[model samples]
Target: MKDLNKQFSLILLYALLFQGLYAVEIEFNADKTLLDSKKEILELEGNVSLKYQALIFEADKIFFDKKNDMFSGNELKFSSLDNFFYGAANIVEFSKTKLTLKEVEFSTCPCEEKIWWIESDEVSFNNEEKIVSSINSKIVVQGNTLAYLRKANFPISSERKSGILLPEIAINERSGLDIKVPVYINLRENLDLTIEPRIMTQRGYGLTNELRYLGKNHNGFFNSSFLQDDKESFQVLETDNLRWSFNFLHQQRLNKSTFFETNTSSTSDPFYLTDLGGFMSGLSRTLYLPQQASLSYFKKDFSMRLDLNSFKLTNPLAVNQFQRLPGLKLNYFFNKNNFKLVLNSDIAYFNKGGSFRNNEKESLSRVLFNPKASYLYNQKNYFLESSISLLYQFKNHQGNKNTELSPLFELNNSLKFFKLSKTTKIILEPYINVAFSDQKKIINKLKIDSGLRFNPFKHKQQFGSLFLSNQKDIMIGTKLTHTDKANNHFKFEIAKLSTLGQKILFIEEKRIDLPEPFSLKLKYKTNNGIIFKSHLSLDSKNNFNLTSNSISLNFNKYKILIGHYFARNIEIYNLNNNSLEQKKINSFEFSASVHLAKNWSGGFKFINDLEQKKNVNSVLSIDYENKGMVVGLAYMKSLELDWVSILENDTFKDYHKDRFRLFFELKGLGSIGKPKESYLKRRNL
Candidate 1:
């Protein structure tokens, strides 16, 4: 019997060995994750931790199948396992170039989200394609509401792409216009272009399109607008006017750090002038328009730029159809820091045209090269630095028989000392800048300005300055924003920042009149969160004067702003200096604004010609956003209230007051999805 059994077993083993039969096999790790034989299925449980290709998965249950090369699990989380730098939702699907994340929160290696988690109902991505698609997503970026994107699609491909769209509007005291329609196209990972069709009761059919491309090594923009009807703005030709324009700007890197850039533009029909106030406005005729070009290559130690820009007008207004030319600049630097030299040249030629012929072409050009060196070293409680610069400029015009050369030298010094004793802080800074110009100008045109600033606490400045040139002015100001031990913030700055951020008080006409130009600002903020800022400015050579004030209050999620201006102003912007002359005029202005939580803001402003006893203009605007929906409205009434004052006192008094704005913005819905994506990504653990 034993012999018979042994023979039978041996026969069975032989049959099994020859058949190559297989058995199940598995390996377990201390973490409780298990790997199966055949290198296929991997199961992870009991506080399971699984890692694959820089991706780590953590969940109550996880599984992977090598057969189909698919991964999945529940209560799962996917993250960049190494740096713990990036991750996705409880359910994540990742591939070479694509990532499909569900309810995922990710961060930079250092952990900063701007507003952090980008929440969405669904997010599908393509890694190789650089495509990221999200539906119903919201995020907070730069403290601004970036919300309510419905079926957002961002294309990774450069040649073609589509993304979300946002609409906006503008309301000024004089006019109002609708903005943002059609679709915004993001292409080639660079340019952003938009096409919109709009209609206005005062203006006829119109379509506006803008294309802007900005990238690491290059950038450019092209814009065109067409309108069927015209309004008061065009004043030329007819209100039934057609308007169109195009702009191109490009920058390219010539080497690792060197680059060349050029810009040129053309336009037709002429509305480009009155709307956005572009150079195209200078060309009222189709035969002649405006164009500009510039090219440069340099970095760090060397740089140079040559510009050729002009508006060729076929139809002349008050000015001639001339060419504005030769706007050029060159610069060079070395010695690791300040040891450097610079030379610049500029010239403008004016031509002639129309019944108001201007055959006379005039030009202004300046050449200067300066070499300077400086040393700067500062410590915690004190800082001191000083530098001197030399510059020379020359001017010549065709009409002016004589040429004038101005040589200017100046020394600048800044010093500061700080002391902080527990609850109290103290700071003192004294600055002096003196410049001497041997230019042919009114007597004693040398410029001098000096000031002392004191800060008793952080950001609280008590500043005073005396100026012997440029309007021969003297002023004193103090400003500060502080938060006491009580946890309140007070803020202020007495500097010049236009409501729209424009550098004010520079008169091109009198560039040769003033020896030196200086602007001073003072602002204050409180420990309890109230703010006030004011600016006292002098225009070209300090002939005209201006006082601007801005106030802001912050309380929780609500913020309010108020601005007041008193202008003893002279000269108009853009117009030639000598062409039009007006004495310093008086005006008073007031503006107020309010902002709420979740991106809602509104503002109102009224400018009055106090000398004329009438309101020059007034405007009100409002904008709000609600979870993917954006709405804005504005109203402007310029010189309307003043117009009523032209009537008799009784009639003016009874003129039924003034009308405010009535406009709004709406972001309707449209999508780029078939909803059912056939190539959708599958989940991976």
Candidate 2:
């Protein structure tokens, strides 16, 4: 076959040979040069160098055909440095759609090992089309260490375009496990989508996907994801069904004087959807739902913004939502020695669905209005403040036919104490406010919560404040936190609930940023040290129940926690005690897992309840990679395997063993849709 191809090429060459015309010389500094008598034909021997097409080339020996208008060389090579270079022991052919080299190695480097080539009769590279085609080719990537072959064609690189492309398998071993194949998608420049394509010898399967996006534009960052699985796949959590979630938010305007951020994310399903809307939105398959969103706007002189959020299942068993007063704030600025005005409002809503009056107490809402003004005296430490409320109320079925007007007022004066203290810092503020409301218009009685507080504290840390605010219905609270040497921190807080009106005390190791409120009272720390935190909360009923109780043994090596409640009495979608007691239970769950030595990770979990459970769910997973070889296993309950399927937001008992077992995730390369375009190559106006 090689002899026949050579003979054919020789024939084609001789067919176009032309008569000699003028001669040109190939100089050799040593008074050596090639003399050829032809218009378009030139040849050089012994370290020949020539230039063409804005590029330079060299060869051991070369031949120029006048009439044929062709260049040929044996044992020839060419280099354009980093762009494109090629070398061949035999022949080179160039055309519009193809550049064929026989026995050739091509690469962007000057070295051989990094070169990509094939052992074939012919290899064609097309730059305009970004395709490499080889006939009977054997291809090698990342050196000859790993090889795959075929008459193959592949696109080189993708730099631009957004959205999602069909996922490709990635072999990663960073998660303390060996990953063979993991499916993934390049969502954007900063975010990539990965599917939990986990399959193993000991455990079944699951599905997990990530959502990540970042922008320094308005000083905001948001990262989140959703994952569901029946099989136990986590080292720290054990449950038949696994719900996983993550959230991140940050923002700043470098050129402006405005900055505010908010973040709220959690993984847990405390709701049983009984509404028609739930099934239609395909929201039931997700075990846990997390919501995070923020808003920030800034300008010179006067600037104000907000961060508002709530993450709760909105369904049969629970509902929760919260809005900060800063959730809605306005500010007005004045010149030096001036006063700044601000109006802030906060609101919260929670509900459980069922038969209710036109407006039942089941749907709840609460709101607070505040108008405040501040004056800076002497600019740095002395200040005067005042604020008043126009209305405050929590209404449901118990509300009135005619809305009543509730007005409140206050006057405040404060001074910096730490400045005078011999200590490093200090602050002292004393404020008094009197509030009165007459609600006889709609309510049986009118109540006011106005008071005075003598607050003295060190803003630089190390002091406590006393609130003598019982002027109407005194309320007091204080928090203390400090991170000492050895990277350990202690935090404790006591706050008045204000509703049923009682105080709760919470203590926990301060980790991460601020500190998680003692709603659930769960506390945790690292393994390098032994630390324990306990939190107890009293409900509106005045019953002292353990909201969060956890203990760590062996320096965070083992932990036990028991508690149930959202952080900060969150009103978002969450189950209530009344509904669970009223409805008969209909579901069950079980799970267990172990992470053995040698990176042997394992887990198992199961769930059942045809009517209340989801028909289809995915388990979370990951893969491991080594050098150029990847191994992967992914298990997911097939969408077809669902026992409780929601169609059009309505769930019914439709069991399919096909969708019940789990979906298997396969790992490998091959994307769907279309190949992505390069960022620089893409034209956008």
Whole-model Cα lDDT per candidate? 0.45, 0.36
Q: Candidate 2 on 1-685: residue-level lDDT in tens?
A: 0111111122233344432433222121111234354454444556666543322457766665545444578766654433344445356555434455566544433243443344556666665554446666554444562344456553333333222233333222211121223344566566665544443322223344544555555433333333333333442343434443444555545456555555554434332222111211223333224343445555554545554444444232332322222244444444454656665554444343222112223333445454555554444655555555455344442354223335544444444433432322323333322332322212122111111111111021110111111112222344444443444555555544232222222122111111122232223354364456665655544322333333333321222221122122222111244221111212222223333333333333334443446523333322332322223343333233222122111233212122111112211223221111110011211
Backbone clashes, each candidate: 39, 63
Best candidate (score: TM-score): 1
lDDT of 1 by residue, 1-685 (tens): 0111111221243244335533212122223445464555555556655554445566776665544444567656554534433445655554444556676543322333323345566677664455557777765433455566676664423335565444434323223343434676766666677777665545556777778878777776666666665567566654446666665667777678556665555545333443433311222223234455666656876777766556444233434433435555666665545333443333333223221234544343333344444444466634444444443333344434332333444444445555555555545555443344332323322111111111111132111111111221222233343444544444443322111122222233343222122345666677556777766666554466655677777666545555555544343333323443443334555655566456876666566776778766665667664443345555545553322122111112111123333333221233221111110111110
Candidate 2 at 185: error in angstroms? 12
Residue 341 lDDT, candidate 2, scale 0-100:
62
Worst 10 residues of 2 by lDDT: 461-470
TM-score of 1: 0.52
